[model samples]
Target: MVNSIKCLLLLSLAFVPFCHCKKEQGVNLYPQFYDQSCPKAQEIVKSIVAKAFAKDPRMAASLLRLHFHDCFVKGCDGSVLLDSSGTIISEKRSNPNRNSARGFEVIDEIKSAIEKECPHTVSCADILAIAARDSTVLTGGPSWGVPLGRRDSLGASLSGSNQNIPAPNNTFQTILTKFKLKGLDIVDLVALSGSHTIGDSRCTSFRQRLYNQTGNGKADFTLDQSYAAKLRTQCPRSGGDQNLFVLDFVTPVKFDNNYFKNLLAFKGLLSSDEILLTDNKESEDLVKKYAERNDLFFEQFAKSMVKMGNITPLTGSRGEIRRICRRINN
Candidate 1:
């Protein structure tokens, strides 16, 4: 009886380490990841984001989009933050990002604050996720507890940025396919695209719709003529490619369902935005549902943002906690 008990004890002891190892090996992201390592990590990120938002209200939108762009390309690994270096070509120069993607300076500010508190402790990927949540809440949107402990990538992927991130001109099917490839469904696509509720788009992004949507001289009939006229005044045909237009004219700086309402009225700013109403029946129903119920939109938007943030993350010794958001650790 004593010999049998000793063997059972050994077996149980061996199983304990195996269970612990399984957890360490699995994707181990959670909201309290830094509770012990750096109790103030989320606080530091939120304070910096709030400062940026106060300085420029539009910054909230810019920061939110930065997170989305990062996740789509390299699975929220902070590859989007990498600057061009020895062998790394930054995604910042990609077609989708070139003159559009902003908020890097704000991220740098947050990273500096975090490093001062706990050097080399918090990951840039986690910082972006937290900032995104704070930005949404600051802009009157619903918030969620962001899972932390994501690690930064050692490199960037310009090709992935260009190919994976949907363009303003991409067809409805193309955009849906891009999201689907990322393990997102049609509901996720519509909910995530609601980020347009607070951002701005370059005139060049949708100027084709104002003039020639189908390679012809006619304007896109799907757009409201009066809205198109207002856009044409600022966007013009010739030299206003860089001029900015609010994505949601009704609630330009607020995170709300007015983006979907505008789509219902045929006033969505980009072809991609309008297609949710015009192209697919399922998407159109979602747009109508969200437009009618702000609570539903907010609920789904929060859930979808959390889902987007969970895309293939590097954790458990796979990647480093970048000291500076813009460069790999030395």
Candidate 2:
């Protein structure tokens, strides 16, 4: 009941979608999709996500990241949740996801609780989408009415995951190309990159920036030298591949413009983040705008999230609602 009211409050805000009227690929996905089949669907998802986030504050960012990874590989079909079993090459082992993608147990828990209340009515893809939005709201971020009714994929894509998801060292053009392929643009890229305000990056993801950025054995000059020195204490030259560092050192847990601010200062943890400022004229301008205007970032973030969630979602009878998110239905 509390969550339901919260949902209404958040949805009624100026940024959220107002009605069940938005379309993608000629099919509609509305916040009220489960009003008949499972009235408590959103509430249940919100409650469980809140509980998990309380237990692990990082869970908020992890869950949000799962939605991004899933959508990028195969049109927001929850292929990233699959485990390796019987011809299904899980995206979990892809170069981008290997040892990086997380929050699966939280997702599993949400799926189980939802199954008891609503059976197989909610798709894992839609679950990921809602979880992302809920996660954002839990961490002092904007809220939006997540369009639902997506379905799970029967197969995972390892190669697609590797090729499609942008890498930490990917050139700005490469990252932009990847986002472009997903029907997103520079605004989406900049706003969505702001999600980094709350997440952590592994040492391996940014070690290159601290040691040898240009293959000339010199540290990346773009990074603040003092910040790079601090990072080296834990990251080292090699072997601390799994050491965790906050992406936004200023406000590691808050969802704000600090990420863009950090990039402006050359203190961004990941090369991908730094390049958002140095690499492209348009993205660079966006980084500047978001750094100065928190409200603008939040507004556009909510909008970009909705647009990204609509990437080729399966509707009508196109896909199935898996009883287990880790595997396709029998």
Candidate 3:
């Protein structure tokens, strides 16, 4: 028995380097728990995100921003979660755009349903996490099965948003550094960038990258001309929704390898996405790697999500199960 154990240990150690080399391999991050009813909760969460938009169309962008900001800052904390006092416990950031009032209403409705079905049982943080997952699934990728039981955060940090989240126009290295801080590898970074595969961005976000092609601000750039031309029509150099751009062309609502193919065609919409091809050969290699293996991308996406979900989460005694996501329970 000891010999067999030793053999297994040795075999694992022997394969370590190979594993490391393949770490940059593009792969899928689908959750292993996917099933007919397994993603039912996630489906509910997606509806909630969409409803947020439906309630207040303007809040749609901000709500999406809130999700990305929250997850990128400290995993998927329910920091976006509110309490009864109308007071946010964590670092109090600015309120979500009032235009999102309708969206907040939708979020409230979803929470109410869960509360009715399993009052105080589900964590708002998990809801946000699942919402993000559901959003991705709705955008056109395989639905990833997220492990449940995430608790709400009692402490919100406005500071986290400025410090941790990557800026839209930051260099590839800057983005890498931020991702590394989150314990994500290059592959994970590449995979996460795939989120852009189906979302829209404002022209303001990538204008500098578009016009300042030779400028220091635009390092190692290679954006597609056709895409740029399209952007020009909607967002001129002088003024427009610079923050606007689409992540994926095919099945924009589904999360899949289409983002990678976009990269391959030099049609990646974000400066961050285009920069991957120029600054890091490995990142570009990953794009190709993932593009070729849809299943692998789903697998990696699942694992990376698990890792992302575990980030500075409001675990243990840090938070509460809010009766409503927008207001405190007075």
Candidate 4:
């Protein structure tokens, strides 16, 4: 065991690299998990993600969001990647993921590429994690060493996806509570929310804040009227639910602290984004710190992402290395 681990370590410095829930902690995941087993795993994922992002800059955010959504539903087990099969209710059909979650094609490409070189040696869950990190780096965001070794789940959970993923209109407390339930805290909530620095939000997601915030038919007072008006031109009072809006108005494609800066200016697109500052003192302080020091925000964002990626990962013989990400092995 020592010699094998040593070889794995040596190969990890240069080249390479689970099935169940043991204690519900991601203790088995490490950056070098695939060093010897599938030395090219991370390389293949990074290449595919870069190609996809270059083709459609928005692809970066889409891929990043995929990891966040997948981790939330079933402990980063790749449950979100499953297609509805016999007895498997796909998370893709859930309310939170129905029209929002995407990037499956990109994942397919990465998985296929890696399979050509490593067979079933790596997990789709790890692919999502690596792709997300690559996406962030492609978008001018800070990068971190992503812990790996998570195994793909045999079943998907539509109900868990619907219930676990936080909504754009959820209250600050509700959002924070959702994070806490996932073993995260306010610091993680604030740092992870920084992901809004890149993605896009659909009109329906934040329409409540624009026209009927609090059901009073008044725009959210926290939102800048000018910005709201601009959004209204595209979002409108009725219809256009599928219309897309940039999350960070100033730098839509760049991953930076601009999301927090926009929050301070009341230009934040989602009610959930604005409430980070307006609702909780600790949350507000975090917003100000990120907005003021991009370096601090980058540091915390890296730490929070690593923490989030560690959520209840499947390891050991707990799960299977899926032959195909969209379905279980035949």
Candidate 5:
């Protein structure tokens, strides 16, 4: 009997690591995670986001990009929401963020509403995911059920934000490599790039292309010359770094395939945007396919968003549910 029990104990111990591995890797987030805990969570986020979008349709794009910036730096744990504090450097100060990222106030409003209904129950990380989905739906883009139960990171990674997030001037290979580091591929990269269809970019983000290509004092020949001339009116060689330009002039406020369409015409606003066509044949083909088929682009975009949201989430007891998004819970 002692020998039999010893053998059983060893077998059970062998399975322990496997079970833990499954839990860690599985993450186990689902659409219904908040269904019972806070039944009104999704409704609260949607209503507030809809109100914000009504006031300024661009707000939808800002909220969507907020989630992207959050996930890319620290795996959708709301680290991007954190302000600089003891032992924590804010990702907001990162190059890709700085003056570019917005929509923090909207998130705060959503958190306030959720706290009223279920105090300390809903996490800011999950709030960001839901808000992103609501933003997409509000802007006539594809909608996907956001998996919930993401916990907030106790610390933020400023270096990760700088190194991991792809820059507008990054070469196509570099951008693809950055996405790959986050477990994304060419399809996800191109499809997620479709989000640019709705947002605006500052003049500084693309001024290099307008004034100099290859460090030569000449405009990038790859850009549509006429389009560049029109851009130069607002985005001059000097000053106007903060000047805003709609990413997709065709359908700026709507999330559509017009971004890809503009790319095909060489009217893409950012070097990053034009590179989809200029740099790699595979991405170019995908861009053309998306431009030709709105449904295909929408479908892939939804899937890619979901995949992006699932990046290295802190679930179970891994991280805290932050009371205030801008600061870690005491």
Candidate 6:
């Protein structure tokens, strides 16, 4: 009995500081507490990324793009995790009716693996970041160390019309302007574009750049040996389908700094991505910096990801703890 009482006293003393702590309203602004770290979450994330990569080789590129678009558009609400009709929410981006369903299908596999290991512990936001990095690594790209602990947003803006998701044809200035709205600077914009190192783009996204926007004094994109010729054949200048072309020549299934290098040599697939390297010296210099120092690219990617994960979080009573990332309260 005496020993039990003494142990209780010690426990009480240990908790005294925490118990006495008072959150002074308006006085202690920015007061924060470090949430307990969960290794299980990280393990599950790694598993998901690897599983997704193995499941579908094609999805690596699209999944990485989805991660970038999600953060850039709505601060990573997992907004990319929506169906075509926007009726069903998703832990992974919806595959049905999507041009990039294969990639989202891989994401669905990852989400399932994570659910089995640690149900509701990993957020869709963190999974997106991890999956992006992993997809790149699997495709022989850089492996960035991304920090975790981002909470999933229950409130996803369904309508794409509401957010500013830039299309493949956006100009250099337009891309920069849209990125700024997300609190990213020129460096972030250029660094993020490195994602193009692996993804594929349809001819629809670049036909204008190849035919209408190319010439002496316009934009000199030195076609990669025969990439231009291939484009001409696939999407004939006269009349042809305008929806078939992969972005990267080296590895369309990986992520790397090759995208910037390609731009340096004039091989960018989309007008917007190419314009960044040629339209402004500052932008060009930033891309060069990322291409040279992949470490810097990884660091900035991690920082940008953290920033993206924090936007418009559902805290307190605003949202409920979702049992699944796809469906709400239901």
What are the models' TM-scores?
A: 0.92, 0.91, 0.73, 0.91, 0.92, 0.74
In candidate 2 the C-alpha lDDT for residue 70 amounts to 94
lDDT of 1 by residue, 1-330 (tens): 999999999999999999999986767888999999999988888898999999999999999989999999989999999999999999999999999889999999999988999899999999999999999999999999898889999999999999999999999999999999988999999999998999899988998998884555567999999989889889887788889999999999999999999999999999999999999999999999999999999999999988898899998889898989899987
Lowest lDDT sum, 10 consecutive residues, model 2, at 16-25
lDDT per residue for candidate 4 within 89-159, as digits (tens), equals: 89999988998888999999888888999999999999999999999999999999999989989899888
What is the Cα-based TM-score of model 5?
A: 0.92
User: Better model by TM-score, 5 or 6?
Assistant: 5
Worst 10 residues of 5 by lDDT: 212-221
lDDT of 5 by residue, 127-203 (tens): 99999999998889998989888999999999999998889999999999989989999999999999999989999
Q: Candidate 6 lDDT (Cα, whole model)?
A: 0.61
Model 2 spans with C-alpha error above 4 angstroms = 1-25, 213-217
lDDT of 3 by residue, 210-305 (tens): 677554333223776767666667666666653445666664545678878877888777778877777799988888888899888888876776
Question: Cα RMSDs of all predictions?
Answer: 3.5, 8.9, 7.9, 7.2, 4.2, 7.8
lDDT of 3 at 277: 74
Error of 1 at 45 (Å): 1.0
TM-score computed on alpha carbons, candidate 4: 0.91
TM-score comparison, 1 vs 6, better candidate:
1
Query: Over the full model, what C-alpha lDDT does candidate 4 score relative to the true structure?
Result: 0.91
Query: Candidate 4: RMSD over Cα atoms?
Result: 7.2
For candidate 3, the lDDT comes to 0.64
Clashing pairs in 1: none
Candidate 4's C-alpha runs over 4 A off are: 1-26, 213-217
